[model samples]
Target chain A: MIVSNMSKDELMKDIMAHDFKLYDLQLYLNTHPSDENALCMYQNLVNDTDELKDEYEEKYGPLTACSAAGDCEWKWIKNPWPWDKGGN
Target chain B: MWEYEKKLQYPINIKKPDPQMAKFIISQYGGPDGELAASLRYLSQKFSMPTEITKATLNDIGTEELAHLEMVGTLVSQLTKGVSPEEIKAAGLGDYYTDHGISVYPQSAAGNPFTAAYIQVKGDPRTDLYEDMAAEQKARSTYEYLIDLADDPDVIDVLKYLRQREVVHFQRFGEALRTVEEKLADKKFYMNNMINQPNKDCGCNKPKTKDCGCNKQ
Candidate 1:
């Protein structure tokens, strides 16, 4: 669950933490596909991360190029690129 | 087949602008054992992989390496931001600055431009997997060296995270290599290779099934 008061950096850290866990588990499951415990954790992270990503994109601007930009203009391009200082 | 993510996989906020450090770290961006080579090596190898598991593993790892490449680029970009020409000269990045003034370019610290010759993509799965394993080790060592040279605590933290990732990737790649070996030894998998058109599915693994997964596609 995301705290409404959290800063963009904090929310991003939360998302990155979830994604790192998910990515590691994905790599593990690539070889150990039958591991039920890992699979369960992976599924849980998938749901959590998706929710987190939606929240992030909704508030902080589009993470992906095709993400929603309220209104007719292009905000994705306006959002700070990753290389911008503290942009992430 | 690829979608662009505007944000970094990991956040990097390097407070200090150290052109010297940027020069050294740019090596990982485009050097011989850099992330670019790592991503290209595995992605290029995916089509030739012998099994589904091997193919997926390579593809995922390759994609992740692209993220790592972004991290390296960010590190370099952040480090070089606002650096003065005098500082650049002092950092021995003079030659680099002459060509690409404050922009991140894919070249080594010693001035060698990135080349495809940096990576190997043998058609043989075992041979290519071995090369991947070695590549991971080389990358891990490069991170270690970079960490050792880094004075900024912020920079070191990111480097450490990236280093640990290299370790995890090494473990995963090693596991993938074993998975490929086991599949190669399985009679069912061996038989599936004689497939009909890929679209035919052929149900090639059944005991009653034979001569499937061929070049008819």
Candidate 2:
């Protein structure tokens, strides 16, 4: 039920936020593996990142090389790479 | 076995190019104590970890280091982007440019290519975890040096974030080492050999399996 009309930058920003949350939770879980609350939160964030990534890639391009699928002509090379102005 | 995340762990928006800064920062991308080595080290070490907690710790931290590697590469690439040939030569990136153009290559600022020799996968949970902790500190110091050299707020901001992660990683590795030590004590085991044989079929090698009943001599 997600809309696909978001600009590339907006989509990228959303993905970045979710990814950062997952990274933070991952490190926390590394030390506090027994925390049920953190485990639950981590699961939710992982789901969010999955959805955001799917939506972004479908509309714009693959975020990672492996995500490039279905008749795409080497799309990984086509980018404002993460270091590029639009890539970040 | 890793999935690629599209976005950076941090958002890096460098508005200016500074090749001089890029020269030193490239070290973090591929230097001896760089993120690349950190990532490779932990990922490689995870396979032989004696406990589930330590294994997961190494895997997760190793993965995070990959993200950090991307961030550092981003910083170096952005900083080196669009500079004049004269600027490149003046910034002392001329040698790098001769080899890599503006693209990011896995090499230290001193022009040493990244080598697996930079990391140790000793296969002992305690030893590897201790090494991981030390690696994080070395990376943190490198970041501190980069932060001092950087003049741009945006670049410094990202560098600070990366440096802070090293501190957090160090703490986590310390905790993992403690967990391994406690497990060793509970089993009345001492790691006497430098060569770790975590996969010995003998039940003594397994930490979680209680009552394997192989008494250490």
Choose the strongest candidate by DockQ.
1
Model 2: CAPRI class: medium
Predicted candidate 1 versus true structure: per-residue lDDT over B1-217, tens digit per residue: 6787777888899999999999999999999989999999999999899887788889999999999999999999999988889999999989999999988889887879999999988899999999999999999999999999999998999898889988998898899899778877787623445464566665663355345555447
lDDT winner: 1
Q: Chain A of model 1, TM-score against the native?
A: 0.87
Please state the error at residue B167 of candidate 1 in Å: 0.7
lDDT of 2 by residue, A10-41 (tens): 88888887877777777778778899999999
Shares of reference contacts reproduced by the candidates, in order, are 0.79, 0.72
- Give a tens-digit lDDT track for model 2, residues B1-217: 9876556778888889999998899899999999999999999999999887788889999989998999998888888778998999998888888988878999888999999999999878888888999999999999999888888999989999899999989988898899888877785666645337655555544565556465545
Docking class of 1: medium
After superposition, which runs of candidate 2 have C-alpha atoms over 4 Å from their true positions?
Answer: A2-7, A64-77, B187-217
